[model samples]
Every structure is written in structure tokens, then in C-alpha cells.
Target: MVNSSALSGNDTESRETLYQSKFVYIAGIAEMIVVILLILCFCIFVCFNALILNVYFTTPHVHEHARYVLFVHMLITDILYLIASISLFLVAIYAVYIPMPICYPMLNLAALTFRITACNLAIMALERYVAICYPLQYFQFCNAHRANTSIILMWVVGAVPNVADFFAMQSTVEQDFFSRNVICDLSLLAVNPLQNTIRTLTFISTFTLVALTIVFTYIKVMQVAKKAGSGTSSASKAGRTVMMHALQLLLCMTAFISTVSETYLRDSPVMLLITNFLVFTCLPRFLSPVIYGVRDEVFHKYIRTFCLFNL
Candidate 1:
């Protein structure tokens, strides 16, 4: 009886081990697949943005002083965002393929790129706000030199948090776990309350500023349309375009907000899928093109050309 009982216990242990092995294998494969898909989608977006910019810049009629400058600004920001997405895709791949104790600097590069791109998005929003709300003053407000300075300043400001994150990382001891491949989260760092407070405040400020900009632009646009006498029809068309762009920006903002909110909820399989889908898969790949393509004259022209040629 004792021998039979011992054999049964051994069989249970073996089964548990086999089950865990299978689980890990499945998880790793899924992570790899997702990362590959993300990289491919990001490349596609980069190509589309590049093509649009090229057409806008190369074409004579579209290269007016104001339109040209706006196109250039859009191109710069889109490139930054695309580069940041590539960093994220690479990091996701590393998290799956590599073991713990990753090359710290590379992770820092990814974080820096992402931070800068976030700032760039906010600045881009502000640019659109200026164009829509103060169209008469836009050429004066965002001249070539001023626009360059603003973009440069945004890069510097974005880097400050990344530098703080790097030093914070050195102070904390890194850990290894079996489930996810080589996770490196700054949230796991043992940081001071002040650091946490600053980070939280920064995020709140950014979110608030973007929300205000969008709202103010929309309101100003409506008011301008109401006051215009003979120009009401033209103003209405411009307002519609601005509104469409704002709506797309709002969608991106909402996705990020949803992801943040989901983090507070207890982690479950369903919640994980939903949050990841919004932040990683859906928002980046789909929304950007739909919004930009609709508003972008160059993109529309090229798309029309392509369709005509194909047909």
C-alpha cells in the first residue's frame, strides 16, 4: 500500500511539470507572434506617412508657405512616432526572446523614444489647435524658426524623465520570473514618493493640456462659423475637417486613458487582452491612417491616383 501511494504522488508531480512546460511554450509562441505582427504594422504606417509627406513636399501646388510648413511638422512628428513604435516592437521581441538582465541602455533608448514621441503628439495637437483656432495667426505663430525651436524643446523636455528613470533603475534590484520573458518595468523600481508624485503630476498636466486644447479649438471653430457672414459655407467646411482631426486625436487619447484605467483593475485574462488590444494592436495600426488620410489632401490625391491606375 505504501509503495502504491508513493507511485501515485510521483505521477501527479510529473503531470504538473508537463502542464507548466506546455503553458510556457504556448505563451512564448503567442508573444513572438504578436511582436512580429506589431513590427509589420508599424512599418506599413511608416511607409504611408512617408509617401504622404513626399507627395506634399514634392508637389508645387501643395507647397504653399503655410501648408508646406504644416506638412513638414506633421512629417517630423509622424517619423518620431514611427521610430518610437519600432522601439516598442523591438522591446516586445526582446521580452520574449531574451532572458533577464537585458542590455539596460537599449531599454533606456526605447523609453526615451516613447517619451519624446508622446510629447511630440501633444505638440502636434497644439499645432492643429493653432491652425484651427487662430488660422490668421498660425503663419506668424509657428514660423519656420519657431517651429524648429518648439520641436527641439519638446525633445529636451521629454528626455528629462527618461534620464530620471535611468538613475532610478540603477538603485533598484532587478528580478527574474518564469512567466513573462525578461520583464523590465520602471514601476517595479523602489523610488521616493517625490519621484512618484512628480511623474503623476506630469501625466495629469499633459492629459489636461491636450483635453483643453481640443475643446478650446472646437469651441473657437464653432464661434467663428457662427459670426462669419458671406464666408459661412467655407468656414463650415474647414470646421468639419478640423473636427474630424480632433475626433481622431480624441480616439488615440481615449485608448491611452482606457489602458491606464485597466491597470488599476485586478489582472485577469480578459482584462489583459482588452487593454493590450486597445493600446498595442488596434490604436496604432488602424486609427492613425484613417484620421490622417481623411484630412490629408496629399494622401487623398495619391490614393485617388493609385486607385485610378489600378482600375
Candidate 2:
């Protein structure tokens, strides 16, 4: 009876070991696939943004307009965000946690880029509203100089919360070499009560205001479009473009929620967290060039000419 029991215990242990190995193998494959996808996204973002920047700069008509000015700034922010995402991906691939000295700044910059992108989208929506609803006032309201000033102000406002986050991380979080790399994870760092409160309030208030403004502006624009019978087709096209921007904003907001939640949900599956992160980081960036640049008639003409000449 004792010999039989010993043999059964040995068999159970062997099965457990085999199961662990198999799980690890599957996880390794998943990570590899994710890494490859991230690399592809990085390439696409860089190439498409570069093309857009080139066309906008080379074409006087496109660059001189206030709307394109805002679009250019949006592209810049997307590039910055992509850089941060690439950095995070590298850390993940290496499986080594970077020290606080490097991690804090990286996370802060990512936050800044995020804030700027949100501001840019809101500005774009406002520009579209004015153009569609109040065509005469559009010129007075959204001049090139004014657009430049707005972008400068956006950078200033975006930096404030991130600067606070940097200080908060410095004060509350100690350098821990043993900790796993949580690259670009602002919530992972230790933050004091005051800093946490400020961060939360700032994030919620800014996003809420921006979102409400976008929604209201777009609704008004659509109403105006509906009333303009002869111009309905052009107005409808512009509405679709605005809708694309709205979808991008929605994706970004969802990404923010997923990122924050993933930090605290320790029991959540790893694959799900990775999928959410990838979708949030890559999808919006990918869509920006497509929705804003490729869809533009001028950009399409330039791209086709360039391609034909090259061929």
C-alpha cells in the first residue's frame, strides 16, 4: 500500500511539472508575437508621419492653413507617443526593470504626449466647428498665428501635470533595482496623497472639459450641416472626418482606463493586459495618419505623384 502511494505521488508531480513547462512555452510565443506586432506598428507610424510632414511642409497651400497646422502638431505628438511606446516595448522585451532615474522621466514624457494629443484633438474639433458653422468667423478665429499660439499654450498646459508627476515620483518612490520594469506606468510609482489628488483632479477635469467641448462643437456643426441643403455633400464629408477624430479620441480614453486598471488588477491575465495596451497605443497612432493625411485630397495627389515618379 505504501509503495503504491509513493508511485502515485511521483506521477502527479511529473504531470504538474509538464504543465508548467507547457504554459511557459505558450507565454513565450505570445510575447514574441506581441513584440513583432509592436515593431510593425513603430515602422508604420514613422513612415506615415514622415510622409505627411514632408507633404505638408513642401506644399505651401497645406502648410499655410490653420487646420493643417493643427494636424501637423497632432502628427508631432503622435510621433512622440510612438517613441515612448517603442521605449516601453524595448524594456518589455529585455525583461529588465530600469531604475527610477530613467523610468520617471520616460513615464512623464509619455504623459505629456498624451495630454498634448488630447488638446490637439479638441482644438481640431473646434476648428472644424467654426469652419462648418460660422464660415466667415473661421478666418478670424483660427488664423495661422493663433493656431501657433494655441499649440504653444497647449505644450505649456500639458507640461504642468507631468511636471507634478515627476516630482511626485521623486519624493515618494525609492529606487528599487529588484522591481520589474513598469515602463511608462505613471500609476506604479509611489505618489503622496496631495500629488495623487492633484493628478486625479487635473486628469479628470481636463479630459472632461475637452470631451464636452468636442461633443458640443461637433453636434452644432452637424446641425448646421443638416440645414445647409446645397452644401450637404461637402458638409457630410467633413462630418465623417470629424467622426474619425472622435473615434480616435474615444480609443485613447479607453486606453487610459485600461492602462490604469491593469496596474492594480494583479490577478488579470497577462495576455489580456498586453492586448489592451497594444490596441490603445498602436491603434490611435495608426489611425491618425490614415484619417487626417491619407484622406486629404492634396496629400493623396502628392503621394500618387511621388509614387509614380519613383516607380
Candidate 3:
């Protein structure tokens, strides 16, 4: 009777282990599905953005200096965003399958690109501000040769800190293992006091500049509209369009802050999920195409022209 009882206990234990294994397998599969969905959405955004930019560039009539510069920067940022999303999706899928070696360098590189592209939206905002605020100075301020140099500097500034933090993180967290399934916690980006300081400062500065740009642009746009009165229908529409873009930019900035804050604070699941929703779940990217397409008279007209031509 004792021997029989021992054998039954062993069998029960085996069944429990199998159940746990199956649960883990299902969870992994679920995670993969989510990741794939994210990748698909990102790819669509990238392709659509590319197409719009191509139309803008190929049509000489639409290629004014201001639009040309904005188009180039938008294309570059979207491409970077696409690449970053791909990298992140791959990392998620890998985490579902295998133990990810703490890839600190790659994590920082991705973070840097995302952050930089985000921050560079400020430059675009600034351009729009100048264009609306001082129409006469627009040509002098946004000239192509000068714009090219500024764009290069913006990217460089965004990329440089990642290189520094990558090495710094390796130095500090190289031996630390947080989880069997974990890759890298970019929260360690704040481990170096100096990097943390600089990052915080950069975030504050970028936020202030972008916020000011939006405020100033709206104020100037409103003033112009008020002056023109009934004759200002076109200008009012343009102001509304810019206001929408500014709102989208605000969403992107909010997402970035939420994600970074959650990471640093090591917040609860609810907090993390909210951050993820803002950062990854099709909100900002969805707005990207809308803001650009609806606000851009050229893009709207050009798409019509293209469709008509094809028809």
C-alpha cells in the first residue's frame, strides 16, 4: 500500500510539471503573436511614409525649399523609427524563445536612435515656427546648405551619448544577471550619474524647445488669422493642420517620457502597460501619416494626381 501511494505521488508530480510547461509554451506563443502584429504595423507605416516622400520628391512642382527639407528629415526619421521597431520586435521574439544575453550595446543603440529621432522633431517644429512667424526670414533661416549641416549635427548629437552610455553600462552591469529571460535593462542607462544628468537635461531642453515652438507657432498663426478675418480661410485651415501635428508630437514626447520613467522607476505592470501603449501600440505612428497627409496640401493633391494618372 505504501509503495502504491509513492508511485501515485510521482505520477501526480509529473502531471503538474507538464501543465506548467504547457502554460509557459502558450504564453510564449501569445507574446510572439503580439510582436508580429507590432512589426506588421510598423512595416505598413514605413512603406506609406516612403511612398508619400517619394511623391513629394519626384514632383518638381511640390518641391519648394521648405517642403523639401521637411520631407527629407521626415523620411530619415521614419526610416530610423522603422529600423528601431524591427530591432525591438526581434528582441521580443527572441526573449520568447531563448535566454537573451544582456546585449547592452544594442539596447543603447536602439534607444539612442529612437530618442534622437524623437528629439529632432523639435527642429522640424522650429522650422515651422520660423516659417509662420517670420515669412520673410524663412528663406534665410531654412536654406538648404545650412539645413543639411543642421540635420547632420542633430543626428550626431543624438547618437554620441548612446556610445558613451553603452560603454558605461558594460562597465557597471556586465556581470549582473537579472533574469534568465532578460536581455538588457536600459534603466541602467542612468547608472552612470553623469549620463543620467546629461540625459535628464537633454530631455528637459528638448521638451521645452518643442513646447515653445508649438506655442509660438499657434500664437503667430492665430494672429495672422485674426488679422485676415474672412479672407483667412486658407490660413485658418493651415493653422489647424499645424496644431494637429503639434498634438501628435506632444503624444510622441509623452510616450517617450512615460517609457523612460517607468523603466527608471521599475514601476508596476499597470504603469508599464500604459507606457507600452503610448510608445508602441500604433498611436503616434498612426498620427504620423494623418498629420503629414491631411495637413500637407501637396501630399493630398499629389496623391489625387497619382491616383488619377494611374486610373
Candidate 4:
């Protein structure tokens, strides 16, 4: 009654304070729900990977084939990739400052496994191409012994850019670089002009070669399928397999490019989490079990028992 303006000001301030608090409370709950969902999905993938791997190991007929061996190798590489990626995510979310020495290995492992995963898809396509197009030479060209050797070569091929980036960072920074503690991030490794340039150039060159290899394999396989003159021939199926691999490679490339997209998304934690985790990183790995593991008649037959028992 005495001063209506002052009373209105107090009421407005109280409402604004309450609104701010409610907004924060809602944001916290939403972030927690997202994290829980992420963890649940991750665990499910791990279990599925384990079940498939167990079946592969326990069944001699399945594990003895060159194609199955290659499949197993891909799964193992993916598991490594998933573990490394999730570890990085957890640390980032918790704001844990890990020492450089410890963090470097984890970061590089993530990078290395990512490269290996892409290479694995390319090699697997080539394996199918050889099996279908040149059946007579399949045993010689893509046998289990050769499959194991290819896995080793994949790691070596993947390590080149990582080693180069490390040396480049070393050249630019002081010797005490390893003594400090910082958040484990890919951007941290690319902190210098030289490192960023190398990263960009390497990304362009390496992925170009990978894409070309996948495209070449897919085309060759398709040509062989057409010449076979039968819709149900192994060549046709192999052609489809190569196409599937191309899709998986596309997913992997999407994850790599997320680092580039982070600039626009840095301010929004929710956006970054969704884009990086759901769309790019985990989507490909999650689809692997569905696309290949469940769809393969042989694999499906073997895992049916395990699924029924576990269900």
C-alpha cells in the first residue's frame, strides 16, 4: 500500500530466483538420465560381444574358418575401442585430471583402435572379395594364418600417424610436457600448429585411401556377382557383405569428424554428449552385432542356445 513499485520489484526477484533454481534442477536430472542410458547401452553391447566371442571360441568349426577369424579380430578391436572411448568420456564428465604419462597411452590407444577398426572393415571386404571372385585361391590368399598376419599389419599401419603426431608435439613443446596433469582429450594432443596440420593432412590422406580400397573391393565383388548369373550365388552375398562394410566405414568416419564438429558444440554439454556418444562413436559398434552377428545364419544358429539360456 505504501510503495507498490518496491513490492513488485521484490516479487519479481523472488520469481526469477526460483526459476533459475528449477532450471538447474531439471538440467541435472536430464544429464543424469542421459548418462544412465549411455551406460546401460554400453553394457549391453559388451555382453553381446562376449557371448559372440564365447561361441566363436567354444565352437571349433566356427573359429577355424578364415572369415570367422577375421570377424573375431574385428570384434576384439571394437571392444578395445569402446573401452578406451568410454574411459575418456568418464574422465571428461567427472573432470578428472589425469597425468600426461597415463593419459597419453589411453588417448593413443583410442586413436589407434579407431584407425584399426576402419582398416579392419576394408580388409574384411577384401577377404570376401577374394573368397567370392577367386574361390580357387581363397585358401591361399585369405586363410587363417594370413588373417592373423593382417591383424598385426593393421596395428602397424594405424600407429604411423600416432607416432608422427607425438614427435611433432614433442618438437614444439618443452621436455616437461609429460610431467603435467591435464584432461585427456584429442584436442590436447593437437595443441600446436604443427600437430593440427599433421592431424588434418593425415585424416585426409589415410581415410581417402581407405575409402578407395572399400569402393574398389565393392565394385570388383559386384562385377563378379553379375558374371556369376545367379541371384543366390556366394558372389552376390559377398557383394552385399562388401556393401555392408562400406556402411560401417562410413560410421567410423563420422566419429572421426566429430572432433572437428566439437568447435560448434563445445558450449553445450548435452549436445556434445548426444552427438559424440550416440550418433558417432557407439552407433557403429552397436550395429555390428545386429548386422553381422545376428544376420549370419551360421552365427545365429550357434548363439541361439546362449541367448535362450541367458534370456
Candidate 5:
């Protein structure tokens, strides 16, 4: 009876080992797929942004306008955000331990870009509102020079929460905190409860304000479009464009759910990979080229010409 019991115990242990190995194998495969998809998407969008910028800069009539200027700003912000975010993700996933001194600034830069992207969206919406609602004086308020200056102001405003976060991080950590080697992650940098609260509140408030601004612009543009009285009217087109910016903002807002997903779906590795890659990392950044450049009549021709020339 003793020997029989020993054999059964050995069998149970073998089964458990096999189960764990299988899970590890599956998790690895899922991670590889996610990384490949992320890299591919990032490269494609970067190229598209570059192509649009090239066209805009080379054409004087296109580049001189306030709308396209704002559009280019959004593209640049997206690129910066993508670089900071994807670099952090790759570092964490592959377990590249970075010193906190080097990592903190990176995390803060990512946070700042998040705020700036929303600010850019709001500014672009305001530009459209002025263009359609106050056609005669649109240049007075949303001129190319002012658009460039507003981009600078957005950077200043966006840096505020990050500055607060840095102080909050300092309050909790030890004197030698910068000497620690750690996986580069937003969660790691934001480990302090105060930091988390600040991030959550900041995200909600900034995005809410941006969404409201976009919505207001869309409504005003729609009212003007009605008076203009044609399906193909420029006012109607501008309304749709403002609506597109809102849709992009909506994608940005969906990232708020990552917090919820982490809480509930954290244990499911595959779901975590998909959610982080698709929702939190990639989707919002890709929408800018589609919404701003491809959808614009002036830019579309340039894109087509570029594509055909390349072909």
C-alpha cells in the first residue's frame, strides 16, 4: 500500500509540471505575436506620417494654412508618444533592467506626451470651429503663426501633471532610489499611491475637457453646414472632420479601461498582451494620419501622387 501511494503521488507531480510548461509555452507565443504586430504597425504609421509631412512642407499653399499646421503637430506628438511608449513596453517585457535615474524621465516624457496629444486634438478642433464658424476672422485667431505658438503652449500645459508626479515619486522613495535597477514600466514609476491618483484624475480631467471641446466644435460646424445647404459643402466636410477628431479622442479615452483590465484580466496573459498592444499602445497613435491627412482633400492628392510615384 505504501509503494502504490508513492507511485500515485509521483504521477500527480508529473501532471502539474507538464501543465505549467504548457502554459509558459503558450504565453511566450502570445507575447511574440503581440510584439511583431506592434513593431509592424509602428513602422507603417511612422512612414505614413513622414510621407504626409513631406508633402505638406514641400507645398507652400498646403503648409501655410492653420489646419494643416495643427495636423502636423498632432503627427509629431503621436510619433514621440509612440517612441516613448513602445520603448518602455519592450524594455519591460524583455526584462531590460534600467536604472531609475534613466527611467524616470522616460516615463514622465510618455506621460507628458499623453497630455499633449489630447491638447493637440482640442486645439485642432478649435481651429476648425474658427475656420467654419468665423470664416472672416478665422486667420485672426487661428493663423499659422498662432497654431505654431499654441503647440508650444500645449507642451507647457502638458508638463504640469508630470512635474507633480515627479514630486510625488520623490516623496515616497528613498535617497538611493535612483540607484535601483528595475524593469522600465509606468506602473513601476507610478508605484506610489499618490502618483496613481494623480494620473487617474489627470487623465480623466484632461480628456474630458478635450472631448467637450471637440463636441462643441462639431455642433457649431454642423449648424453652419445646415445653412450652407449642400452635402458636398465645405462646412459639412469640416463638420465631418471635427467629428473625426472626436472619434480619435474617443479612442484615446478607451485607454482608461486599461486600469480596469489590469485589475480583472491581469492573470490572463493573452488578454493582457492584446489589450495593452491594441488599446493602450497602438490604436490612438495610428488614427491621426487617417483622420487628418488621408481625409483632407488637399493632402489626399499628394498622398496619391506619392504612392503612384513610388509604385
Candidate 6:
């Protein structure tokens, strides 16, 4: 008769092999789903931004306003942000490990774009304030040239803190059985106390200032709108537009918070963190075009027209 122990051992081995195979299959399916979602997000992002840009450029009335100029700059930043995010997602999927030179630059660009986006929102709030609270001076104060200059200045200012981040980064090579690559983990930037302090201060200060400006300006706008009676129906409309922008700003800030806290979340499951990051990144982009299209009359009119013609 066959030994019972031997048969039992063989059964156990077979069960182990089956379990491993099933795990691998499940993991592969999950990866494929992640990739498909990323592609879908990329397509939607490009399409929405393209729609806004087309409307801004093709319609003379839309382009004449300074606010649309800021919107265009914001859209450019979102495109860059999407590209950076896509690069990171691809690296995570395909690369055994990302090299420091590759990783740091991508992260820094992402950070810079995020900062510029915040600045753009604050500036947009100021523009709205001027338009609503001080209507007579809106044209004189917020002309196209000034709007363009502000956009340039936003990029320049946004780059300063990220430059510090680039210099402060440290990297080392990590090795697996088959391959080795440099890992410039962002948490390393915080290892240096001074660098960490600087980064924290700059981040908090920049965002705080922008947030305060937006809040204060909107409060003033609302006050003016309330006081101006029925003659200021446009002011009420502008308030709704500003409210949409505020919602967009809040969404972006939530993403920023998630990114900043990533180091603290090192113990969390890697896949979970990645999934959360992707949601935060895509949510704002998906909603931005919708918000603008619904809230802004010119954008709404053009989007409807374009949709109908295409249909």
C-alpha cells in the first residue's frame, strides 16, 4: 500500500501550487484594470481640455475676456499635471524600480504644476472680486496683458520651491534579483531637518495665503452682490461661478494633502495608496470641465452647440 504520509505531502504541494497560481492570476487582472482606468482618465482629460481650448480660441467673444486667459493657463497646467501622473503610473506598472533622475524630475514637475494651479485659482478669485465688487475698474485693472503677465509670474513663483526640492533630494540604488534601479523616494527629502522645515513652511504658507485671498475676496464679492439689489443679477451669477471654482480648488487641495501625507502613510498597502492617488488626481480633471461648462454662460453655449453639431 502507498505510504499515507507521502500521499498527504503530495496533496499539500498541489494545493500550494494551485493557490500561488490563483494569486498570480488575480494580481494580473488587477493590474490590467488599473491600466485601463488610467487610459480612460487620460482620454477624458485631453478631450475636456481640448473642448475648453477650442471654445476659448475659436470664439472671439470668449477670448476677449481676461478671465478666459487665466482659464487657458489653468488648462495648460492640468495637461502637464496629467502627463506627469501618467508617467508615474507607467513607471509603477512597468519599471522594476524608477531611477532617481527620472523620479525626482517627474515629482517636481507635478508639484510645480500643482502650485501654479493654486495660484491661478487665487488669481481667478481676485479677478472675480474686482469684477463684482468694483465693476467700473474691472477692465482697467484686469486687462489681457496683465492677465498674461500674472500667468507667467505664477509659473516662475511656482518653480522656486520645487527647485529647492530637486536640490534636497537624495537617491540610492535598490536591487532585486534580476534588476537594479535608483530610487529617489520623496520621503528622503524630509530626512534633512532644514529641508523638511523649508518644504513644510513653503507649502503651508503658499497654500494658506492663496486660501485666505480666495476666501476674503469672495466674502467681499458676496457682500457687494447682496448690497447692489436686483440691478446686480450678474453679480449673483458671478458668485455662482466663483463658488464652482472654490469647489474645484477644494478638490485640488485634497489631492495635495494626500500627496503630502504619503510619507506618513508608508505602512499602508501600496496598492491602496496608489488607488487613492489616482482617484484624487483624476477627480479634479474630470470635474473641472464640467464645472466650467455648466457655470460659465459662454462656455455652456459653445459646448452645447459643439455637442449638438457633432451629434
Off by over 4 Å in 1: 1-33, 60-138, 163-183, 188-190, 229-232, 254-282
- In Å, residue 22's CA in model 5 sits off its true spot by 5.6
**Candidate 6 displacement at residue 137 in angstroms:** 1.1
Q: How well is each residue in 1-311 modelled by candidate 5, as lDDT tens digits?
A: 99999999999999999999998999788777777788888899998888898888888987788888888888887788788877876786567998888788887877788788788888988888998898899879988899889988988888888888889988888888889998987767765899889888998899889988998999999999999899899899888888888887877665556545655664666536565666665787787577668777777888899889998
CA-lDDT, candidates in order: 0.57, 0.76, 0.62, 0.82, 0.82, 0.75
lDDT of 2 by residue, 9-128 (tens): 999999999999999899879977877787787787788778788988888877778989998898888788777766864675355567656776666677788878888888988888
Q: Measured by TM-score, how close is model 3 to the native structure?
A: 0.73
Worst 10 residues of 6 by lDDT: 171-180
lDDT of 6 by residue, 97-204 (tens): 766566767878877888788889889988998998888998999988899989889888888887765455333222331132444445533545666776778878
Sort the candidates on TM-score, descending order: 4, 5, 6, 2, 3, 1
Which regions in candidate 6 have their CA more than 4 angstroms from the true location?
A: 93-101, 166-181, 188-191, 260-271
Q: Quote the lDDT for 182 in model 5.
A: 89
Which stretches of candidate 5 lie above 4 Å from their native place?
A: 1-23, 191-193
Q: Please give the RMSD of candidate 1 to the true structure.
A: 6.0
Candidate 1 displacement at residue 175 in angstroms: 17
How much is the lDDT of residue 62 in candidate 3?
53
Q: Estimate each model's TM-score.
A: 0.67, 0.83, 0.73, 0.93, 0.88, 0.87
RMSD of candidate 6 to true structure, Å: 4.0
Model 2 CA deviation exceeding 4 Å by range: 1-12, 89-95, 166-184, 231-234, 304-311
**CA RMSD, predictions in order:** 6.0, 3.6, 5.4, 1.8, 2.7, 4.0
* Candidate that scores best on TM-score: 4
**Winner of 2 and 4 under TM-score:** 4
Model 1, residue pairs in steric clash: none
Q: Compared to the true structure, candidate 5 yields what TM-score?
A: 0.88
